[model samples]
Target: MKGKWHSSWLLLLIAVVLVLSACSSGNNSSSSADNKEEATSSGEPQDGGELKVGLSANPKTLDPILYTGVYESQIMRQVADTLVVYNKELSDFIPSLAKEWKVSEDMKVYTFTLRDDVYFQPGEYQDGRQMTAEDVKYSLERSAKESAMNRLRGVEKVEVTGEFEVEVHIGTPNAALLAMLTDSGNIIVPKEEVEGWGDQFGSHLVGTGPFQIKDWQKDSEVKLTRHDKYWGEKPHLDGVSFKIISDPNMMTNALRSGDLDVGTDIKGQNRELIKTDQNLELLSKPALSLTYLDLNNKKGPTADPKVREAIYKATNVEEIVKGVNQWGGAEPSFMGLPKQSWGYSKDLEKLKPTFDPEAAKKLLAEAGYPDGFKTELYLSEARVPYGTIFQNQMKENLNVDVELKVVEWGTYSDTVAKGNAPMSIGGWTWYPDPYFFLYQLFHTDQIGALGNGKGYSNPEVDSLLERAVSETVDQNERAKLYQQALEIILKDVPRIELDNLEASAGINKKVQGYDVSSDFSIIIVSPNGTNVWMKQ
Candidate 1:
């Protein structure tokens, strides 16, 4: 009797368990069916949301021609339209403002046909005027006095050929002409707006793009609204707000707390933290930019080639790369150009400086600095860690004592432009061509406030670059010439190449259709957010 009772109890428990399992399965199926129905009825894209972005710094100026930093370019991209733009891989170009272009047989003249559909944003100065060839000519000529004019070196004249056609004549065939036109500085602006704004135009920007600046508060925030009359597809978001947050920690916190839909320049361990969060996504791409230490070749101890070589050899680039591990998947490099650039040479690897303390010590003694010397190393507050790493390496390996002078970004740029710092940590984002990498930064003519802040010059480098741009039209021939130029520049060691950076951003899961580009242009990330949508 006892055994029968125990068996009956076991059977009852099993029956209850089965009944509960069946109920749970039915509930899951019903939920899935409801979700599928909702998706089918609403369509894939749901719009009407505001994107809040956290920028690492405030733009110094909004005027495309005067601005040189990436932060400024980020804002300008939303307000301006360029002639050409890079593809996703940044290996080729696509038409933006201009619908089509024809090159002359000699490649000295380029005739561009503007699109009649494009219209400038409606503002106090502009009454929804259509952009014409005259506006293109005026914008190009106006930017001639800025540093961006270096890209237009050989252009002899810009002439309006028709109501929607313009011809740019170059004295010599420049291989980088098309790539130069893709720069943000060449964005077409309404002639009337420029004349009305005059000196205050930097604050009051006007252009033909997907978004227009509604309000701008220096060192605080910028508000942008969508342009309903844009030539391309309308933007999905009603507006975007860019908040200036210089502190990486604060920016990371804001992103994690859902205050910012996207954040740029999030580095270090914060990247790892952001990756682990289930509600956030991280976007990153290997950038075609380089960070390096520029040694003043005109004065002080670094002027000697031996000293510069000693510093390069003694520094362990691998250690520095590790210190900035979260910054990107970076590796040591010896040349100014990114490894993936068109004209980059693999043969140059054999000439790279190795870590040799004995050789560095001997070179330092030869340069009359046996007891070492003291110098101030200028760095921006955002990149102070990189400078500190180099400083410690130099002190430990070569006995050179480097004092760090960390300042704000604006001040650091001004100091470097004046050639005030003895040894400074600087960087450059060159155009996608070798001409920009060699000519703009290493040429003697650009020694002043342009990209050549190191004050280093070599006639051989200048000659090779000139030939590569003007004489060599073939890609292979141009690459060979650039390789020869790089060999000579490496021998001088004016700047110690650190690593190629990877631009990174933290994004909330609610945001979609956003991506980072290898070229490191903020505008390339879904230009104007037309395809981007948000989940409610």
Candidate 2:
């Protein structure tokens, strides 16, 4: 009887154990399902997705050394890495290919210590070669050629001190060298690969960046794949494709239609549409660019300082800024450097020219043009509105009849560079340093090809710019020098400063982890998509 009772108790215990196990399994399954649903609903970052970007223009070249356009730089940045990069706010410099660096007491030499873990992406020439000091020396040497804009003008030589260390010697103490190195043009590439490819190096990019160029179709699209061997954190997206859509309207439509994850260089007319779209996000910021009417100081009626001043006084900047830039607007400017730049002066208002038609007429008469002169204002399609506004303002105020010549972007760039345009609407995107603003645009050296398109040069201005670049290490001192230079430029009136432009972009809601830069350069925020991810 005792044995039978014990057997019954054991059987009951087994049954209870089976029931508890089943309940626990069911609960675990339900919890997992809920967690997965939460992840999906909450828009959590997921791995392995593709991001499609719409660009307003096609990238001219993929070679970092040859690329001069903003769009080209944006694409090259993902495939190549520079030694240094600007911080998120572009207020300070941070490490990139070079892990750390040191400068000499004289500030003429810079030494960089390369990272050991960095390896080039697999390619025909690069069999996963480890990046070293030799590659740095080779890349810098190749960029110093004349075709490369004499980029390393002040540099004496680049030497490989150790296996993973390089030293750069400069002729003078250049304060802009460090800042200039942050440019995408100074990216390091594999030396052997560049040599092997020769002239075709632009098409075959091999670097230690987050993305590798998988395919490129000129004037159409460029496809890139993630580099699994990247030393930094892997990108969440499997790939990114840049689709070249020259028309701003088409780019905006593509973003709205879910065909594009990002649309760049959104024009003023499309800003309202993008803002109103529920599925798109509008990103706007003040660009570090100055759009102005450039009067050729080399020749024509504008050669006289009085004529330039008259034109400056006659034009109404506020009207144009408000009328043309309706959505993503701009601020009226009195000088070449934008207000956002470090060296811009708050006291610029004192030198700013006010709109006074009487004073302009008087100046024009004094310059031997009492009735005003007729001239052609060359412009691209993008700047037609600004050109028209300027023409009407000049006609009404100064009795000047200006004919507008609308041309393609390529022709406009070439014509301006050749100093053929007597008066034209021109724009320049300046670097972080005020010296770049003063030196590149106003210096006598950069007359035809690179900068100083107006051929405006002053002895005092040149001296001040030279001093600002070489004579000082203190930022405050440099700012003072630049301010002095700017005063001279404003007085001379070579270029009538119109306004500092504002840039805008349309981003799809599906894209995440992207920010527009104050400088209007997408590359400034994220040279590579390591921090950018897409919602699954």
Which candidate wins on TM-score? 2
RMSDs, each prediction? 8.3, 4.4
**What lDDT tens digits, residue by residue, belong to model 1 across residues 1-536?**
99999999999999999999888787997877677568645656555788888989778787767777778878887788888776666665677888888888888988998888999998778798898999998887666545453545566778999999999888878878888887778888998888789878889898888888999988999988888877877777787889999999999999999989998886778888899999998887667788888998888998899999999989888888778775455677779888767888889977878889889999999989998999999988867878888999989888899999998878787877777878888777767688777787889988876367779899999899888977746778889999999999998898888888777888998787777756666652233333666765
The collision pairs in model 2 are none
Q: After superposition, which runs of candidate 1 have C-alpha atoms over 4 Å from their true positions?
A: 1-45, 66-69, 105-107, 125-127, 145-156, 171-173, 196-204, 214-220, 296-307, 324-330, 362-384, 401-422, 448-455, 472-476, 524-530
Residues 1-536 of candidate 2 have per-residue lDDT tens digits of 99999999999999999999988787997877677668757876667688888878888776766776788777787888888877766656778888899888888888999888889998787698888999898887677553264556677789999998999898888888878787777788987788789888888888888889999998999999998988777788898899999988899899999989889988777889999999999987777888888999988999998998899889988999888888755788778888777888879767877889899999999999999999888898978989989999999998899999999988888888888898889887867788777788889888995367789888998899988877766778888999999988888888888888766778887677777766666651243433777766
> What is the alpha-carbon lDDT of model 2 when measured against the actual structure?
0.82
lDDT of each: 0.82, 0.82
Q: Candidate 2: list runs displaced more than 4 Å.
A: 1-45, 146-149, 296-304, 362-370, 405-422, 447-450, 523-530
TM-score of each: 0.80, 0.87
Shift in Å, residue 337, candidate 2 = 0.7
